[model samples]
Target: MSLFASFEKLLSSILLPIAEKIDKQVHLSAVKKGMVVLTPILLLGSMAYPLKALKNVFSDSAAVQEWFINNTYLIDLLIKFSLGFIAIYTVIAIAYFLSEGYKIYTVGAIALSLFSYLILTTSVNPDGSLDIRFFDSKGLFTAIFVAIASVEIYRFFTERKLVIRMPEGVPDFVSSSFELITPTAFIAVLFISIRYFVADFTGGLLVPEILMEVLAPVVGSLDNLWVVWFVIMLRLLFWFFGIHSAVLSPILSPIFVQYLSENIAAKTLAEELPHFVTGGTFSAFVNFTGSGVTLGLVIAMMIAKTQRYRKVGQVSLVPSLFGINEPVLFGAPIILNPILFIPFVLGGSLIGIFPLVLMKYGFLAKPFFDPPYLPLFFEGYLTAFDWKTPFVQLVQIMASFCVYYPFFRIMDKQEMIREAEVQAEKEKKSVFSKKDDELLDELGLDF
Candidate 1:
């Protein structure tokens, strides 16, 4: 009957059960966050063979192997999806360890996530056995690290009643979890390390078979850009219609990259060699949502700056159109308002079209598709040698900024207008009240 009770029921029905299961474990270590990212990064390992798999599954390509290499760039996008697993797991793990402590269920959840990847890795590879080899080294390190985390997580769970007996040398906020480290703090450390590893690998293209990734965008015509373009457009459309961006990303990005490799293969080795390592998307702006369209959250940040000149002209430009409007939406308070939705859709549309046009022309070379993931910016340069990819990126950014700037300015001015009206109304009300009081005395009025 009460609002709180309704809310409790809703939460328990939806989020609470999931929270309860993971709550069985408590982890407060940097390693725990690594677990958060571990799933996504590991899952990306599967993207290494998208087109090839599609080629085989559909028997689509005349040369499946060639198509496979051509679309190699999608691997990165596939790998990036694994990061989502890590993020979800890490948050749940951290939340549980902080609130409920650690238990067998906690370990099971963590193990479930890891094994999910392991099973995925094994089943995906036909010839390769359980990769018990990497399991020894990487797996061992991960296990020991997991043990430390589980120990802390377990203690935190059963010992929740003793949080007041918090560690003597520790800070207060951290003591809330009954765990050794906060999820955020530990995850940050894990982030730095994983980021380092992704960038640090010396191998030219050495994601193990267990972690091999593929980009299998289903295309209609094998030799045509129109088909590829159609696929790309379909991918963009899916952002509005559905959640297949993750499934489609590995396919669309590799189209142009495949072209780039062929177009420039005879020209120079620098242009033909795959530039990105691990074959995933590097554009922070784009994700499973597609590049530049990160979300309304990005748009929110841009609008939040509090200055029209700062907020409108330059702030929302680069991010809004590229599909990353989280800055503009959250920053600007355009959220939940009908007025701002006009610019959001319009800006996104205009910015989205320009690059595809340029790619159609000779102005920009298509990306080489090694480690395939959709790229929004110059990061598309990660593909095999398309020297002009940077130019195309610059244009996309400039175009996105241009379209978003005017729209943002309009919105900012409107925002200012509303604020002025509110202030004016307040001032007028105050003056009228004081005048009425004086006039009332003149009339000798007393209610």
Candidate 2:
């Protein structure tokens, strides 16, 4: 066997099963679902700073400036409730999904998880108000941990039938509420004790702070260009084998979200955004026109000699423009097609990272806004609010065309040959065969 065949077999034998397990894992599934639930909220929150920044467009108008100044608080409210308390929202969503998975009382599990997160991350100030400094992106890791842990605790007690069971004839809500009393008390005491223990042991650091500090290196490394490139490459490799890229979301989504929140915070403060990589970066650049950057392949197909390829291309065109490419991936059948593997993986990676490299060099601005699934060039412009962004996207598309052109020609030729042979076979099997024509001629029937 060839080297590529050996490598392909190795990946199928090893990675496919592992990917399947990750896809089905309950907690990860909950996290992916939770992020999906939060997407709309995140999009609304991300718009806050950009909308406020719009005042700059009318710098010549004092009235517009005054109006913006008067309504700054209204914009701030969007940020305050959405991104400001993002961790709280994340925990609640994750807990609800996870409890549903465990076949337990979802309401009780959600309440316990929220309580645990607040208890671990918040404090009462001397002014008798709550201090919620970690309620935003800073507490995401803690939120995830508390959500999983608290739900598991609720699941444990409920599974063991350790709850108070109200007698028959009681209302279902009443009975369910009573069922959670024991586990609630246990989780409350357990978390409170740990909170006190951590405070004493760490000289006043809270759980979220401690976690951020402990994981600082890992989080910080995500900003490196090489690291981001490696991740994009890995995702493309998984796509090459026909695996959905979302399998990596359980691990990467939270970090990307945290970075995005930080960027928006920086934008709101009118400061330089700290992170170079974000979820917006991936959506606008790396996965532009869908994973493996297959929009160019669609373009290639649209102009191909094969009628089937041209039809698939025309069908996939609109969806690809909106960043949907499953039609292209499966229709063009790039997945597991060795003829297209190099362009899909290596060429896609190179195209994906080109704009990021420009951002690193200060030619392009880093993404602070994360508008969802707007059409291609428009999405790029909205992401960074820069006029140059669309041009950069055009360059990436051109690069994609160049990379996929030669490989696409090879595939098109093979398709053409296959179509011709099939047509020839159909002609040979025609209803009026050559022998039938001869018999008709021998009968000398006049038309």
Candidate 3:
């Protein structure tokens, strides 16, 4: 068997099944769904950073500078209420979705998870005030852990019928509230005990701090270029086999989100952004013009010798400009096409990592913004708030064109040959028979 056959067998026998299981896992599904729920919130809140940066843009006008300076509080308020409380929102959302999966009371699970998370992460000030320093990205791991743990605890009790039973005559709301009493008490005590135990054990460290320290090595490795490349390749390989590639999202998105939040925080403080590989990096670079970087293929198609290829390209060009490439992917039929595999996977991966390489060398800026989908080059500019980003994107498009051109030419040639053969067959069938022509010639000899 050929190397491609071996790979196909390995994927179908091993990777595909594993991917399907991970895609359906309840905790992971909840995390993915929760992130989707928070996407709009993050997008709206992140606007504060870029909007505040507008002050630097209009520095020539003293009045505008003063206005921005005075209105800095508004931006801060937006950040404070949105990104600042991201962990809280994350826990609630994850808990609600996870509970729904367990077929339990979602609101009750959310309350327990939130309450438990607060107990573990929130601290008391010397002056009797509450401290919520961990309510941001700093508390993300703790929030995830607490949400899952608290919900599992709720599920355990509720599934086993361990809750207080209110009489049937009572209202459903009151009865549901009563049912949660036992689990809430158990979760509250468990987390409160853990909070104190960890504080004493670590000589005043909180759960979030401990988790961050423990997971530091693992989290830090995400910045490695090789690791990022491997992940990019996996996504492309999945897409090559006609998988949606979203199966990996549940595992990767939380880390991407955390890195993005940290970068946004650093930018907000006017500090150097800490992370280079972020969710925005994937959007602006790796998945440029859709997964597998098929925009280049569409470009090649547009200029092909064959009419079919040109038509598909023309129809797909508009959507590709906006990062939608399904029309080209299916039309060009890149999926499982051995002729296009090399450029689709290897070339696409290289093109995807090109901008990241520039960022690694300080030629391009790290992404801190993740704006909603806009046209290609424009979105790249918004991603890093850097003038150089659009230029880098242009280079990527050109690189994609170069990488895909040769492979596309090969496919175009084969398609042209196939089209000619098909046309010849049709012409052969449409020709009149010899006997019919003889009769026609006899009847219309003068004409």
Candidate 4:
């Protein structure tokens, strides 16, 4: 009859089951875990530029400037090897994980996937070396698709016992080397055929470019506020169901990074902000404190009457402040909690909308610099290279708090009631056990 009860029924009947299904789906599970495995390195890569950005703050100081100038090589090194090769890592990770799920040999699968990915992305420089552009974010979608497809092919051949098998006397290392030959050759040929022989759908565009074109309408529409909201909303929705949002990152990150790149280019040319929505916009602004903007929710919980809320809030608060929310999401158990469904998602979606409105009215500037590792509001300010953006972030935090507050209170009350019931049941059990103990003592005397 109550709102919480209705929520419980709905979640049990629909949301929880669907979430379980998603978590169990092989490909989706692979994508989620694979991307998660890559998050740390990607996060480190994202942080690489912040050192340079911090150095810029002291540009007027000769000693500080000299130190940064001397260390520019290090900054470049971090960004280049890490973020620069992100697509390569993504493909290898996806292939490795998918192969793991299919019970295929991981190392060979990764090698095959990497080889096939390179085949599809083969581009030559004027100096005859391989062009590295597609090895980065530009080739992300290609990398993901190729990784998945290549692994499937590997699984197909290996599962059917199509590969040459070594006799019992051979070493595993030597045996695997021979076993890898057939599947690797097949994977190589498959991609090679698609690369060279497949008919061009969009006037000689390669697979990645063609895929980009197919996704163009959606990517192009990101400039619209509604589309941005929808994308962010969908991400939050998945997170609520315990799905790792990074599964969609390869698809969305390229678009976000492209828009951010355009913003950087425009700034270099002294032009206007090319687009309002960007990767930096989401990373530095919308997801200021991780998915669901749960820093605000963490704060709300910190003030709650429920003991569980307060404890989890304390544990999650500091991390959420820095844009990580897993401690609370899993600890407070946000997933499948009906009381949190509205706030966890809708609150996060709200964070994305505020920036668009601010940009429309000239209250905030579009982000230009791509600084990372900086904390929430600071990250926003650095990205925009404008002080006002931090102020906007503060306002957004307050707005998020307002959005999460009501639902949080309801959840807090539910927790308190549950705790009370649990305590009463424990006391009742203890009383009955004590009475039984007394009766047992009297019977022991007769015995």
lDDT of each: 0.41, 0.90, 0.86, 0.76
Tens digit of per-residue lDDT, candidate 3, span 122-209 = 8789999999999988898788889999999999998899999888699988898999999998987898899889999999999999
Write one digit per residue (lDDT tens) for candidate 4, span 71-154: 888877776676667778878888888988888788988998899988888678799988777766667777878888888888
Give the TM-score of each candidate.
0.36, 0.96, 0.95, 0.72
Top lDDT prediction, candidate number: 2
In model 3, pairs of residues that clash are none
Q: Is candidate 2 or candidate 4 better by TM-score?
A: 2
By TM-score, rank the candidates, best first.
2, 3, 4, 1
How do the residues 114-166 of candidate 1 rate in per-residue lDDT, one tens digit apiece? 43224222222467644333332222223323344434444444356432347
Q: Which residues of candidate 3, in runs, are more than 4 Å off?
A: 432-447
lDDT of 4 at 412: 88
What TM-score would candidate 1 get against the native?
Answer: 0.36
Cα RMSD to the true fold for all candidates = 16.0, 2.0, 2.5, 5.9
Greater-lDDT candidate between 2 and 4: 2
Greater-TM-score candidate between 1 and 3: 3
Q: Work out candidate 2's RMSD over C-alphas.
A: 2.0
Global CA lDDT of candidate 2, please? Answer: 0.90
Measured with C-alpha atoms, the lDDT of residue 154 in candidate 2 is 89
Q: What is the lDDT of candidate 3?
A: 0.86
